[model samples]
Target: MSRQMCERPDCGRGPIDEQGFCDVCDRPPLPAPPRPVPRDGAAVRDGAAEPERTVRAGARVGVAHVRPDPWYGLGLVDADQAPDVPVISSDPVAEAHRFCPDPSCRQPVGRGHGGGPGRTAGFCPHCGTRFDFDRPDGLTIAGRYDVARVVGSGAYGAAYLAHDRNLATQVVLKALHRSVAKTARHERDVLVGLRHDSIVRILGYEPEGPHLVLEYVPGEPLSARDGDRLETLLAHGVRVLQALDYLHARGLLHCDVKPLNIIRFREEGPAGALDRVRLIDFGAVRSHTKDTGPVVAYTRAYAPPETDPEHLRPTPGFDLFGLGMTLREVCRSRWTDPATPGVDSLRLLLDRATDPERPWWRFVSARQFAEQLSGVIRQVVAAAPTCRQVTRPSALFGSMPEPLHGGLGAARPLAHWVAARADESGLLDILAPFSSPEPGDVAAALPAPLSDPDDPGVTGPAGGALAESRLALRRRDAVSAAERLTAAALPDWHWLSDWYRGLVALADGRPERAAEVLNQVRRALPGELIPPLALGLCAELCGDGEVARAHYRMVFDTTPALGAGGFGLARVLLLAGERAKAVEVAEQLAEEFRYEREARVAAVRLRVVVLPGRARPAPTGEDVDRARAALPGLDVDEAAAASLRAEIQYAEFLRTRDRLKLSDAVRALGPHAATEREYVALVDLANRLRPPLGRGRQGRRGRTGRSRFGAASGRLSS
Candidate 1:
């Protein structure tokens, strides 16, 4: 057989492969020379009767499918101010004070002997250890980085700000101390494989100097600035958590996550100014698989108490604990506002992230920590009265179908129209406005906890059992729910199991017991809003208004997207005689498109709702007018709309004694009555409220009596 030649005429060395490429040249066969085109520009057919080519190579085509990232900044802060990049330190060589690199003896090595300038390189007098404080000022490192100055130094390494000759940008050159010089390769291995926006970028490492080249973040350490929003601080925490989660996913731990390691800066982009944070300093990063042994390096205050320097086995939790402490310290500088909306949730979040008692119970993953931290940010943003944000669905709970309106969102009862009383003046007194919904109703209405997909229970019999328990509770079969949960044989520490127990207690009308059980779940999942929301409902059912208010406010203020939480909060606020505040909450709830109609109607009713025994004042004329004005645009059914009209008219009658208007409004509701009794009651209410006829000259002398709606007979107007 003849050997196939290379595609190129001059490079015919070996046989061409099936891919039409010569093995020697490693080059694909060149494209066939362009075919000659006919003058008519129609067809170019080969003698073999080849098919016509329809799809040409490199043809301009249809729209390309591009999937852009959906995430932007968290929007918790107004990051519109562009911050100036901090200037790099000058005179770095002279500024880098001489010190022994030996871990055992880090004493001063090159200090002046007789009030003169210190030497740059020398041996430590204490341990006879060689030390080099030589500044790389003008010298190029690894033939690429032009040394600038020493920015930071520690026992393990010293960071130098250097300009990259190749990249034409500044970078950090971290040179490890001689004692831990080998760690540079370990850090480079961890960093080179990672790519996340929040994490620092790694360049090539120089083994000779044992230096790790990193992206230089031109900003200060993560901190609270003057006029900074609390959410801003928490947002930084969330970003750091994201980086940590990315690292943990790859079986790596950033064992030294602290404020100093996270750099916060401002970037100006095409869209606008943006506040950004980057996690840096991977010198202490280590593999999770080989975490056992003496800790190489870590800040004492940020590390967990259990982390002994002599024998430390670090987990992902080690980084999370450090982040928790970092945020705690930074936030302390401006954490004076106890009344801030998400402050309690923030405390709960940090507590869970750094739980001292149960080391295993602390945040199990960075993703888990981010979920709760993000929830807290929502709460903080939602606390503003004028702020209306899009509702974010809870990650840990299913949607709550119930509005839990507590009667404010519903129409007046049939009894309110039929059982009304009229005075001698032909004025009808309707039933007092509805109070709170039954606690049993609120309990059943609360959102159900969603089981974590990654949980071991999800793939076990307990998962199926938990679902069955939820179904049983929904059917009001408390007994079945309890039995299924008991049969599941879940571990005692399983939060989902306790969650079901709480639901069962609620189903059984034992809110006090439910509260106790749910509180345990809260401790287990402290960052979750679902637990607090469930607890709020339980407290409300138990009539512990104070506790309910706290819980409801926490969840609602965090994110009004949870309609149940908002409605529940509004209900208790009204019950507590905070009529104005309750109305405000309902109005805010109306801002959410999903709950707009219900929330709007609730706001109208709350303004006129009469807590008969409470100290709340009766609805004023302005309140009645407002309710009437809001009724026309309300997207409710005929019956609901008529009922709302009648409610407003009744309030108007109380304010201005407009009997004619009240009677007409009441009569308008007749067609919507579900039963004959209800219709008749509505008629009676209208008739009783209707004005009597004027008395004739001869009829004035005749005897008069009260109308049928009146308690007793009285003189008639006719």
Candidate 2:
């Protein structure tokens, strides 16, 4: 077959089949003649002198382009068709210095080591050009950028709208005032080296008479204009998060992200104009080093208490806290009633929004902050990392039988259903896994209930009444429950009693104590699977992966059958880094229990194992049909049935869309409706499935400080 011609100019060689290029031009296959070299020797080859053509091409393609640039490489394009060379401007250093802003410098206002005030001042003595400061209007330092207009100003310095005469493009210049120019320039030098889609682009900087001329961003700040409301806020927040996600992925932190710092491009729309937001401003950005000091510029209300002196330490958690707070503001702006309290007031209110007795008061932790905000700001805030227990799958939310609540006088519809079916025998059989055995077991459980019933008394064991009263105390407030649970007697008092004790410890911010008590219960009652499951939970809360995995394994191994409960356990195990074992257990459970909840959770986890990092996968048409067919025979309550249907439908969508993996699809179940345990399990599963990819995401790594889980457990068990 005849070979194709190279696409480059000035070459006529046949295309190399493998590279799709000609030997001379090395251009991809094309049907045109190559352009000839200019007759004038003065004509530059690639925007450089004739001799420098090779150098310019080398620079454009990177260091490997030097020498004959080994034809070892494949296809190439014409010089003109090649990617544009990265523009490299003059170095700010080796230039002259201007009068120092500090009083100690003593040079005259407009005079310095450099010829002109603008040029000298822009160039720092220690560092070179102050890229962080605005350039002087009249001076042409490097003959590339020309100062146009001042865009805005803030704590850092003035931002300017400028034109790059050479590049023929408009850009925004952010520069510190003369006083902060030196330090700001130093910071800019470091920041400009980073490349991310979300971050502002850094062109180049020049010293121009006591000032620094820097590259300019062309978009408007998000704070500009009005009209756009909820959608605008959400879009802006999403973009900011995406940027933050990118920065975090690159190991950089944009510590100064805020509404004002974000830029928006105005595009004409049907009614008016719409703003597209993009994150800008990196003067305060850092490389996220281990030695990061207390961050100072973080806004007070948005900043979590951990950034406070009492909790002075900066972690990715710090950035997450800010992100959560920003999300709350955005969501509240849309969701909250305007009459009750506006978004601004809510922020102020939360500043003093103390419930010292409540477990949530300790918002010093980022996880706690994220959880609290997630509750109120449903749409914007990502799931809370700490409230994992509150969102588990097997949680006792609406799943409990109706009449059962009549025992506690809390709404008995579920208990009544249980009672109506109580004589059915089949109903009891269906609930056998969840119920305790023997009349004595029921009687022992009854004493704590019959005692005070309402106010079982206090935490101490004066009698059965006291134990009931102590449990009652938890309903009042986290502190009251914590106090009571801490005083309660030893093991075997009640299964739920121990469970609640663990919860009390968790609520009290004592995760270690909660883990201890929960672990003890797990050890004592291997047959009672809840305790071991809960023990795994406590270990998870304390960020102890090994311990959590062990406890979960115990539950999986000891449980007689794999059903929704066991499937849930397997899901958690899979999340905790035991994918192989999780898959094994999940496969077993899928064979026996075809319950929608179990199957969905198992399927989702399996997908995670199959394709990690992708979004939650949708169940296939076959999976949906299978789930639908099984639904009629499933013994789940009506409400649960409805939920199961929804989940199945979602799984089908995942299968069709092919966006997420199985584990992600399973995690898409969201939080449990009522049971804190199920909610926690869900959170733990999500964590395990996809360990936080970057700074703002959640993870279980290198946990050295006081455990937030430990504190939460202490509060619960206390």
Candidate 3:
């Protein structure tokens, strides 16, 4: 009889299989409950960590049933578009114990080797080693730590949950592979000296044995992080980059930096980005300047193209590449992200990292990489405004802006535009589909609606998405509309969901949220101008004059006659003390919309105004005469035309001493203004100021020249 090798991290000893099951826990696999979206009248989804479906009597679903504990529903979003936290699978990480005792001859021997259920007890077919997975508990080590549970076992080593008596804390003790353990001591010695906020702290070194104690971060790996978002991951990337920068400054490189080695602490916020991150499992740290050994450990998914052990020169560049790979996965988390505007810039960073041989310039240093990732992070934060969101200076755009009460008072227009360009472009035309107000109308005015087709969700069934959402919006049940779109969201067409959510937010009177959602959609699909238009409208409604002005100007500059853009820009300009520019805008609009009634009225009204904060300089003699000449063919009622002309003359009289010739003024005045209210006011004032009215039609009044006070009040009463 030969003893088989048991390779389970916790059960490292082999025992003879008995009673058809291993001595260790051998219960059947727990079925993962299906996560189905609740239908129109179906019961709501359970809010358990691993929620099981509720069963009705005689229901076809005959699996194990469990009622949701009321306590579980705490803080659940409770709406149809509730945040979906993924359930972790219960499947064991490692294969069943069936190999030989000798680690080298780890061959299968049990009956279940292929498919059929095998006798738990077996001898290795190759080396005749008894394959037993049963091992005892309460194992102690080096008279200090007690192994309480098995954490994980991998190609590199085994991790165990243990209690450290000396420190009075729960710690992780890694029992490395015998071969690697022989060399891990030197690595551990150097790791003890390394200290950083983001790097997992090494508690103590068990110098005489294979195990070492490490601070057990109470969190899951990046892959298992609950409710992850692009912003959240980008935050993690920033922290990791900081750690990497610190290590590089000390001349060390993390040869392995993948999602598996990243542990996100539970204390961190999910969305707002004020997060705590820990980089763990430094099994492959080396001196970038001096360490010239073969690559020790690396996951191929994140390792650089040049990581072949035969030529692997571990450098800061290698670790930077690893971080790039890690962040790429982070940005594209399991939670679906329709390729957002930031995706492209992030991809460039990734391409540089995973394959640096092509970039010509050696891949960027960690600090530079952090700067790039910080940009992506800021855009993400700006795109999604959260209650607790931190306002960080954007590396992509610039620094903090000067505070202002109103107006386009701060921020560089061009820099702001370029920074937000990718995100705002695709959303302007987003509402075009809703114009028809019915699902039966058309998909869009154009066949292939200009959008980023390269985005993940655009490839799915596309025709009815916008139409269905639009019709739902027409029903005025914005939440229902949002839910329908969210339910219909496929991985490839996720932007459609965001589109309707934005519309819902806008319709429901949540401009800030609507702006946030639309901005995200803009970033995700940066090929069109719809988002910018929508963003401008949102900013306008939210009273963010600067942002609205910049966005509106962008649209008007590109498409001068896009009615919304022109109107929005004019309003923003009028508020910003740009009276002349506002008049010029109206004039430009009048030219573009020649013969249009609304446009003509707008030009006349906008040409003369005195609002609270904005006091336009009095009209010049030339402007007064020009208005008088252009009044007749202004395309408005005779009364309105005459009123406009007289108003201009009144303004000129008030502001300039330039004398007006009554004869020339009468000649230039449109024929329609004879009985206009403004003309009446103008004539009455001129008569009173004339050299003693001689009982003509104007002799009814005995008023001399009206004082400035009387004149100002008279104008106000009119």
Candidate 4:
């Protein structure tokens, strides 16, 4: 018999030498049949079985009995012994499990119970991680510390007061929220290099799973205390200034320095210890190296005027201004007080501190201010300007005047001495001669008015007449000054002379011409605040509310604490029916001057007027009580008070009615229907309350109608 080679490609055994059989590829030789069906009995022809009813060994019989089965022909004993094969098809469940690749998907496949896909048995459809059906007992950090309490939350992350079992200490763990984990890590790396006593310490850092741990300082914020004594407050201020100076030296600006960020530590050792003050909250700290970026920190009252929308660069000077304001707060014990002196007043007081001609007031600068305070206290409160003056005795005390004494008093002798020196030069020289001089005495010594005042060219006159006229012009006579400048032929005095000329025109009520000149000057000197303020007043007088608003907005926007100036701008906006914008300005002013009654009243009125009806469904009795409490002892103008009362009543009525309707709609239809119906009602109410259309006297009717509607709407909305 011929032998065959192995058919399997991976098999290496060759066919048997003589039989041509490969055990690896060929079927094993079947046991020899008891008797090979006799070829004669089978009558095999061409390797086929004969057509006959035969019952032979290894021969398969069928109902027809005409053909043999393939397996039977292949030497199988019977066809019934053949192996069964399974059919293959696609499975949707398996495909869905593999479809999603995100690991953090909430709806995982096979975890169908809670935000999961049911198709896959144990896999996530959204994020293909295996489903964890059992809820975690609690989230762990650093494989040790467990979350205990949320200390605080901010844009970067949430701070937690967590207890460490290993160290047996309570530390604040500031972990970055998922949104800013990487950024927090980067910030941590940057801040790790900074070391300062005032700065909150970064005990250690663990950048694991978007979390960071920081040492927590336990104390009260400086802002929490009220009615702090000036000496004590000043001492605390010095410490903060030292920290700020250190920060600035290191090329960093602690942009946010409000009272809230200052931490006050209490020690039992001594009553006047200086180390009690500490500055914290470095989240808003910025490196001064960057050229441009949005202001990262803003507290309405504490932020400087330079922080307006238009101002871009943050200068060291800006920080100085904030420090100045903070120091002012410490000294004054209030953010604002109409009774308190203005910046000019404070400056004048400081200037007069040493001059014998003027009465002695309080210390003007921080160091001098600190000297009045105790030593330990002084060390902490002295900031930059004051800190520099600390070591200099002359800077601290040289300017102060000797205390007057005796029953007769030093008034007369001082007056005589001052009179003897009256011949000196300048206003100060003339005024210096009088010790506690009466207003009449100073007026009596003045040079007489010029006889030929109409002559613009004359610089000198007899009997000091020209000097007196010049003084008068400086003190008053804006129009006269303008006329003189207009008539003058001098070339060198154009700009300065023109400025006076513009002032005169404005004072004369010719705002159109004044505006023309002032605008020119403003273009030339953008830093000047007076010209812009004058221009705004001019626009207001000319009945150009929009232009006036724009100018006043610029001024108030730049210098937030300009008192009545800010309120004036807000008034223009309010009259223009720009309630929202007006409210924003008013709120800013109110916060900037929290103690100012007028500012607070204006802000409250604007808020009530502009509040959206939907935002407040119904005003409660408590709301009315609070509003009334804010207005205690305030004697507002009759018109303003009436208008405010009307608005409040209308708001209350509108709110109550709408709330009832909303409740019914919600109960009957559904929450969705109630929302839509409420919106429709509010729109209808707004339309009815809208002011009339037009300008000038014709617009007055519309204005009144709108005001009335607003008043009515407010009551209903409340």
Candidate 5:
């Protein structure tokens, strides 16, 4: 058989290896040449381009939609208006303290001594190295690119604005400095195969000056303008993560991911001008598989502290660390409000992304990073009252079977309607709507964290053991679950093992232990919301209202799609006697799609419910009126509606001690009783609440040993 020639360009017709790589170049063979299609729709030969299909307007490569959440520009205030592009100086002057381009001699050369003006062009005094700061004068690169001026410079090289003579468009000529010349071909190879929208495109490479011809992105660095929303900056961070994901999949790493390498500009969309970001400058690009040597090109400020620039291994974590620092730097100016909805989540995300501790603790994949970042963006956008973000289910956690709304979301029980009792003052106290559910119920109700497909523990016996343990927990067989967890030989540091242990503890009603174990998972996956959510439940169970509040707020403020977080936060806030804040939480939750009805009911209840003897202040007249007005229009069953009305009327009765309000409350409870016996009991309670025929409005103020529904209650018991 004839030896196949490698199809890679400029490979000098190298033989193709069994691995489909060029033997001479050690790179994957380039894709087959595109065949040309006749303009008249006639097929001439096999070496022709495929017929183009009609793609939709918003079509994209790889995935239909890369970003799950639509970009909300500047907190919904300037979403329709694109950010103004910074005007680039065509003829820019070099900085005064310009350094030598040589890597070995980076001493400042252009600085003025005493009163003399700095020389724009000179030799470095310290190392006798030639340095030039003068703008390119009539410089034409590769006969096709006309160099204009130096746009920017970095550790690897200086980028110049140049015009492509044949293409009639502007391009960037990244002239590699002499020190980084060896990486020029590597950077070229990395850029040639990249075709992501957020990634800058490569046109051609010239070997004479060793320059990379790149698509010119006319924009400023990823930055915060005045009035820029923090969400906008985070949105750009998410896009960078997407681009990083693409690069990492191809075994390439953009080792230097900084704000200057990301270009932000405006792109006209169907709605309006949209803010867009592009990842540029692949000078630091290296193959994670092949380039396992010393780490050379990285900004110290953005690089991981644990990594030595001279000898760090090539891992996705290195790039992720740089991205985290870049986002932190760019978002610092816009993160003015510490109380901003997604701020806490964003902080947690960056913390996990750039964790200086064990390498495994940081974000492992770009998709994982993007998932949390996108969620944070949703929260920041939804925090604005004028903005309504579309709710999407969590990819990390399964859907919750219960709303965990507690008493606020449900009607009063049949017994509550049938066996109501009056206090020593001949008045009945209204049941608080914001009562938290039993801790055990919350522990059971929280959605389980989904197994990560990328996790090694997700396969073989470890995965089977986990599934079996979860099934046992679901069956309420804590012993069996615990046994399975103990028997399984999982690694000590495996997060899945800790997660199952927490669940087992929770199932066994050991919330304190569960809290401890779940907190470990939180440390393991700081970007995830489930750990904090479970911790919130554990805290609530332990009656640590403040701790629960903090944990719930972390999850809920990040993404209301996790409805359990919202309900838990509201319940904790209610228990803390912060009624207004609790009601606000519920009202905000009502704005989200899937939890709308439950949250609406909770909001109504929160405005009026008062826990007996808890020192919780009674609802105001405005609160009562709003609750009453909202109750009738609520989308609930007749019994639930009646129960809600009864609660509202009972609240009014307690406030004013009005017989009419008390009677309305009693009448409203009729529909609440499911059985005839319960109905009769409710009627008896209503009769007992009535005013005495010969007594004043206050009646005889005295303690009664007999409960109001004592006879009916005894009858029902019999």
Candidate 6:
């Protein structure tokens, strides 16, 4: 009931589709306003003009169309002509801005549903529903927030753009209707305590006036934004999930999530092209742990299908559905053009996240949603023409570690078992989500294959052989994957085939061959992004850090959303002795792009080790400890950690019984201690601390015991 019904007289189109596109024109549906009453005993069509435009939030949209013709295709306006209405002001919300509550009877009753601006307060002449936004305009009830302008009105309350006398900045004053005032206080309590970039901050609240003040963001509602690109739309989607995750973590839910409640950073995306999405309107917010019954404040377009009165106590999955719906509409605005690529991948993500029946299995929570979207964004960015100049860090990578890819990397992948080990999700799925992470291997790490093959069908130019190669790689048979690709019929598919072949060659320890194959792919598909990434791999393996840095930068510069590209660039920067740039790139990868864990470790290394900009002696005990501390998560340089532990123990022994602690020192050194130079240092320290053999004393209590076990650190430093 949130949208007015299309008045084609015979057509069954709702005013807005799930994507906020008009069913008739594919344009964004106009805001619904009140319809003028019919005259002469004839049923007049409600609105005959501007049917696809949005009216004021509570204004009744006239629906007078009399069986209009059906049209299909993308709906769009001039890029420069989209309306930019900054929401919030002191003046009462315009009569044209308010819509009737009736879903079927959308008739305007305010000052000028027909001629002049309607009165500030009145009953709908056509539907007889009373509406008001006049109360909070002049009253300074809280004494600090001067309710200067009425920006908007809704079922819960009237919102006024106000001035904070103390802070001298703009803020929104929500003067809630007494019926929902308690909910307003709950919302204030929820928001005032939290601070997140993607969520609006609650400044203060006044109990007497039953109103709350929230920070004013200078942007238009997403409903007003049109023609924005799909990347920006996806960014907004990630931010929304992050906000929801933050809320769910605190046991609260913003049950009434919709496009109208989101603020686009500006008319268009930020210069960096990252969507700085801020969620507002927390009226239906309440504790997920506490059952509050069916909530009245929800928009049908983005509301989950499970809002049954008995089951209205919101769940994290429920809110996740709402967010999915909201993102769909935002994304659909730019997907009108059939020529636009990446829509299929994005729609698949949307479909998965909003799967009313089975969302939780794949995206059980916001964190999962963020992670999957991270994969989706990588594809979209790689497919994109170019990335924004600046991009935000990804949240998905926040938990991963700085992958230890050694220079000229330990010949091929260590072993099948080593290649098979993974924590969660695909382990070596660096650049192959779209190419398809060889499920066979990543899944090998798991007890079995993905229980529910969420793997998508190939919609890109690449086809079956590409998938086969990926499977082969996961099976640790890069030679066969390479051989099969070499003989495969890749006519126009040459670039795509070679791109994968280059990866296979690199996996097989043929960096020179990988470089040759990638070079061919580059010329064949100069605009193709995969070549840059593949070439970077070859370059790094060839010991040309500068060339690797350049290629990786090319990939990341063209698409910041691709984690592999950004991660590669961060790694290259670190290797190239560009500490500052490496730290910046690492932060961006971790924070905005979802490469969370790896970036954190890389940043730490840049500070404690890599950034010193000069070769130093072996890592001191403290230095090794710093490195050890940075990689706290599973799947890391275990050898480094082992050596550091041995050193710590040996140092402790130096300060205590040298010979007595020898056995424990040996335990700490781990195996392969003699192989790594760092571990060997610990052996020398242990040897120096050993009780000197007494040539004169025929039986130095432990001298004979120590001789049989000098250093005794063999098994500790693997």
Name the top TM-score candidate: 1
TM-score of 3: 0.43
Candidate 4: what lDDT?
A: 0.41
Model 2: per-residue lDDT, tens digit, 1-718?
6654454456655454322224454333332222233423222445553431222221210011112211100111111111111232322322223234343342423333455434433444543333323344553334655655445565665555667788888765554545556656766675567565545666766543223444454454444233333323444444455566556656666666555666655444564544445566666666666535767565566555542432254544445555545555545545455322123223432342222232122233222232222222221121122111111111110111111110111111222222221111111111111111121121112112111111223222433333333334324344665455454553344333555566566655566776666654433223233455555555555666676565555444433232423444554554455555554665555554334344433443243222233352333465467546756764446555544444454345444432123224333343322444443443333333332335333342423222223322111100
lDDT against the true structure, per candidate, is 0.69, 0.40, 0.50, 0.41, 0.69, 0.51
CA deviation > 4 Å runs, candidate 6: 1-139, 223-227, 266-275, 292-296, 307-313, 337-340, 359-362, 387-718
**lDDT, residue 318, model 5:** 85
TM-score: the better of candidates 5 and 6 = 5
Candidate 3, position 307, lDDT = 35
How are the candidates ranked when ordered by lDDT, highest leading? Answer: 5, 1, 6, 3, 4, 2
Clashes of each: 2, 94, 24, 37, 5, 67
lDDT (tens digit, per residue) of candidate 5 on 63-126: 1111222222223334554788677775333453266655565566677779886887767888
lDDT of 1 by residue, 528-584 (tens): 677888888888887889998999888776678777788889988888878789889
lDDT of 3 at 398: 12
Query: Please, what is the TM-score per model?
Result: 0.75, 0.35, 0.43, 0.33, 0.73, 0.41
Model 6, residue 507: displacement in angstroms? 22
RMSD of candidate 3 to the truth, in angstroms, is 26.6
lDDT for predicted candidate 3 compared with the true structure? 0.50
In TM-score terms, candidate 4 sits at: 0.33
Off by over 4 Å in 3: 1-136, 207-209, 224-227, 267-275, 293-296, 307-311, 333-348, 355-363, 387-718
| Cα lDDT for residue 201, candidate 5 | 93
How big is the RMSD of model 2?
Answer: 27.8
Q: List the RMSD of every prediction in angstroms.
A: 16.1, 27.8, 26.6, 47.1, 13.3, 23.5
Q: How well is each residue in 110-218 modelled by candidate 4, as lDDT tens digits?
A: 4245675554335554444553222212435676666555545444544666677677787767655445555566556646866766666665666564556666666
Cα misplacement distance, residue 135 of candidate 1 (Å): 7.0
Candidate 4 off by > 4 Å: 1-139, 178-183, 224-227, 267-277, 290-301, 305-311, 320-718
